[model samples]
Target: MPDSISVHFASPAEMLFTDPQGRKLGKDPVHNVEYNEISGGVYYQESIGNPFPESSSQNDESKNIWIPEPVSGQYDIQVIGTGSGDYALDILTYDQTGNSKDITQTGNILSDITQEFELNYSVVSAEQTKLQRIVNIDIKPGSDPNSINCKNRKEVISVA
Candidate 1:
């Protein structure tokens, strides 16, 4: 006779609601919302809006928001938006070795509606890196592609 052992893992997503300065905004008592930390990503009760300045003139430089990459291995990143206007999201990933990858997704949302999209990234030797990398996410209005704006209810999920 052979004996077998089973192992189970609980991977709840971690919700993050903060500004660029790492201020805790989602945990406010007024909102009264809590998020669960999953294995690969987070399950936020609400979405995160873009925090970049809108470009006024052609000579103005584009604004970009930077966020540290969560995991080290390959993952499927997802983003969701809810609004009436159409917006574009630009994602840029940078590794410790100075390698970078870029991804862009468009969301044409209507009034009182929602839209979602996903991007996939694979790292060959993720184990080699001891620390997580950084990823810059830029959101802008579709009409003014070069300018930046805040996206309402932007949800991000990472599944390894």
Candidate 2:
């Protein structure tokens, strides 16, 4: 059995949060975002906003990635923004029932924002027969011009 699974991001845009000036303003400079994981009765919390430093040159450092003990059933993955900018986040997890669910909110969020992305996988044991499951997430462009910062942005997820 696997104790914990690793979540990987292919690009910085999928992980990091940037400012209007394109300068990194978060503690996790490389990924530029904050994350919190709730699993196995443990409540792991991390602040996810750019408490803008007094000076533009000042940097507040923090962790961008989280790895928690794997739970057998559904779990929640939460993402929070640090500043007023465009954000694209990718989250992966397993669901015992293997059902698909999607939740999306697109708009010009003046203040801090929080979004949830869900991943589901069937429950299979070592002694049981091996099977393959496919999960797909499709992101399309919205009509709102002011809230359309993620245009032409593409991200892919593959589970085996």
Best candidate (score: TM-score) = 1
Ten contiguous residues minimizing lDDT sum, candidate 1: 1-10
Model 2 TM-score is: 0.31
TM-score of every prediction relative to native: 0.34, 0.31
Residue lDDT tens for model 1, 46-137: 23343554844222122233334433442322222222344444555555444555555444544332222222333332223221222344
Supply the TM-score for candidate 1: 0.34
Q: What lDDT does each candidate get?
A: 0.32, 0.32
lDDT of 2: 0.32
- Clashing residue pairs for model 2: 16-31, 17-32, 27-60, 27-61, 27-62, 50-82, 95-121
For model 2, the superposed segments whose C-alpha errors exceed 4 Å read: 1-3, 7-55, 60-69, 88-110, 121-160
